[model samples]
Target: MTEKSFAADLKLYDVEHLLLAETGEPPVSARDAEARDRVWEMAVRSNPALFDGPVVACGGVEWEGPRTLRLFWARVTYRHYALRRVPGAVALPSLFVNVLQPDTDGRVLAVRMSPSTAAPGRWQLPGGSVEPPEVGAVLDEATLAGQAARELVEELGVEAADEDLRLWAVTRGENGSIGLTYRAPARAEATLHAGLESARAADRARGREPELDAIALLADAAELSGLQGAHADYLEQVVRRFTAAG
Candidate 1:
């Protein structure tokens, strides 16, 4: 057996945050396109509390406080006409965050990968998948925000407090199966703590110290897209939306 690259098992799970719940691709028929438009329109007009499976949240969940806690609700989107079973579709809404920080000039907190990642050497915003409490995943909405700040510290060897971070806004995208999204902002530098054990280990194995080569603010939007793979595109789209709206 062979080991998969970090990028391999690194499941992008875009549907976890964007418009994705499962994975399947077929040529969109004219009828499919028309139906998709209708569904997409319904999704756009509908609140985030419509889709809730035992596993994923479809919409109508109430979020409370600064943490964005989405309490469960009903009136879920029970119709996924595309698949017999929803792949990444969750009964409950999952949580995730987009990290924003200042650059060396205190402008933007863009980042470069350590080349070990699938998007190695590309510029991207720091983020990850979120597993809600029901699934027993470590990261939730609030936790993801904290992780954003923590990732700043560990990846850059800086210390940033959760309070100082700013909440941008949550946006939703669906990949035909799953549906959800979140975006936030924060400062550039902070006091780093070796909180991410696996990330630190990966660095150590490579003979580099933790946060040795983590995220850094990019010069601007143009410099951010130079990265390779899905990560680069992911960062570009996410950051653009985040900054544009802000």
Candidate 2:
């Protein structure tokens, strides 16, 4: 398969606008539904706490220019991710916000996902699936940035304001998932380490499993190959771009 390209310029339309323009239902047929159910059952058996929540995933993307892309949104249940590994199943591409933090020394921070979550043990930036806007509401750039900021604080214990995040690139994976990548202001490595440790301890105190168990600082793309588990297709490209810019 050919590798996908990343778009540096993005135009985010309101969720309401995208829904109005969306054409077809995601290609989930009865067979796909059966496959999803079987996979979901096994997933829940492994981790019964999984909840099928409502999420807004990217249904499609269109390039309007060399660097500009427009995103379309769709409503999907969290269970739809189970179909990702099922052969020939055309599931809605999950839209997630990935925040890449580069410290003053130029190392980018990546996290190792916890075993209880989907894509456990995978090394990637801190992020989560996009949730749908409230009924009759529209999701705009500020709201999306706010979600990214919240993920940083919750997962890494780093405090970054929404305006501090700059949407740097939008990458589409081979599986069709879209990652809205953002770059935040660089901080001291010691500060990041302390914040992460505090965050992990807080999770344990709350009786909740932290989403990430380990964190690594990568100075270049070559370091990514040393990490474990599957990574998003955009990981290397994002790391390279960030490192090069520094």
Candidate 3:
């Protein structure tokens, strides 16, 4: 498909207008199961600290414009991402909600993943994968905003009201992962730092490593270069867009 055609095919949906359908089964094979085990073993051997957990991944995306996108969801373990490195194997894209917080000074907040997690040391906004809604439950704008708020509280100890989040953009990464980015109301930078520190201390007290070990405020995209390790390809774009808008 031409670049123009591809762009045209992509559409943004308001959280309220988004439609999500459960696929009922994950995109995995017996071979994939075996590969997942082997890859996970190798990964744990390398880090000796990785945790395996259930995570939801996307099965497919159907764009029905006029402001709507339908997402097919699946329950997959975190190991599924490793299968992407296997030759001739395709892993379905995962959808996640990312919240961009700009401090009162206009610097954007980014977090560094802990060493025990997948994508350790990478810098990205605070968020997690979209899980399947409860049986008989409805997934809508309120549900998504609630999830975003939960992440903020769990990961950074920042309590943001659901109404304070505005769905700003949907970004697709080079590997097809989708990020539903939201803009959060700005707060004092000191307040953000204190909340994160408290969250990290609480995690340590519970004998668990926090999901994020470091946080930085990017005054502009140029500061992003100073962060160590890999980053989601779309992160730079998000930073630039937010910084420019300010």
Candidate 4:
């Protein structure tokens, strides 16, 4: 693979046309499978909260026309990503959805992953790995938007209609993972703060730690530099684009 294809920086694309097709999981060698299992066990030991839940993985993506992409995917568990640590393993890329929630002032919301969650301390938009749809169900743009909306409510306590969440952009970054970004309606800054507090409180009541530990409203990508911990690879690019448009 070319260096550019695996570059750490994210390549952003406008959401013009997207096609999703189901495909079989990438073949794994016996050695790689054993290594992957060992890595996942070690990870679980380190973070007991880790769950090997079902998720969608991006098999590959190809361009059919300008601003058009055809993405092949397969069902896999979170443990499948552990294969990335196995030598010579060609791991499939992760597929996830995130929402760009801006306040009325055009400041976008960014949240930090909690210690209990994977990627602890990393600041990113409110989102999670895309869960595979039930058997006989389909995965598509509308489904992705709905997942994004659900993430917004879970992380930020904001309820947005799935239809109102517009497909904004697509990003490829860390581990060649694919992300679908959605734009949500702007809300008052105070309202956002209140909602986050409520969400965190609810999680606590359920005896579970909140997925996000902190939140920030950044006006531009440069502000990301001021954050204490590492920033998600696609965050700066997404923030810059959102801020520049206003």
- Listing every candidate in turn, what is its Cα RMSD in Å to the true structure after a full C-alpha superposition? 14.3, 4.9, 3.3, 2.5
lDDT of 3: 0.78
Name every residue pair that clashes in candidate 4. none
lDDT of 2 by residue, 191-241 (tens): 888989989999999999898888889999999989877776677887887
Candidate 4 residues 65-151, lDDT tens each? 666678788999999999989888988899999999999999999999998888899999999999899999999888888999999
Question: CA shift at 145, candidate 1, in angstroms?
Answer: 2.8
Question: How would you encode candidate 1's per-residue C-alpha lDDT over 55-158 as one tens digit per residue?
Answer: 22333333333333342322222333322223432333333344655433434555556544423455555553333333324333455457566655556544
Q: Pick the candidate with the highest TM-score.
A: 4
Over 4 Å off in model 3, which ranges? 1-16
Q: How far is candidate 4 from the true structure (C-alpha RMSD, Å)?
A: 2.5
lDDT of 1 at 97: 48
User: What global local distance difference test value does model 2 have?
Assistant: 0.78
C-alpha lDDT of residue 175 in model 1? 31
Using TM-score as the yardstick, the better of models 3 and 4 is: 4
Model 3: what TM-score?
0.86
**Candidate 4 global CA lDDT score:** 0.89
Off by over 4 Å in 2: 1-24, 85-88, 228-230
Query: Given candidate 4, what's the lDDT at residue 36?
Result: 96
- Model 1 misplaced stretches (Cα beyond 4 Å): 1-95, 104-106, 115-122, 131-142, 173-202, 205-216, 225-234, 237-246
lDDT of model 4, residue 122: 97
Best-first order by TM-score: 4, 3, 2, 1
lDDT of model 2 at position 214 = 86
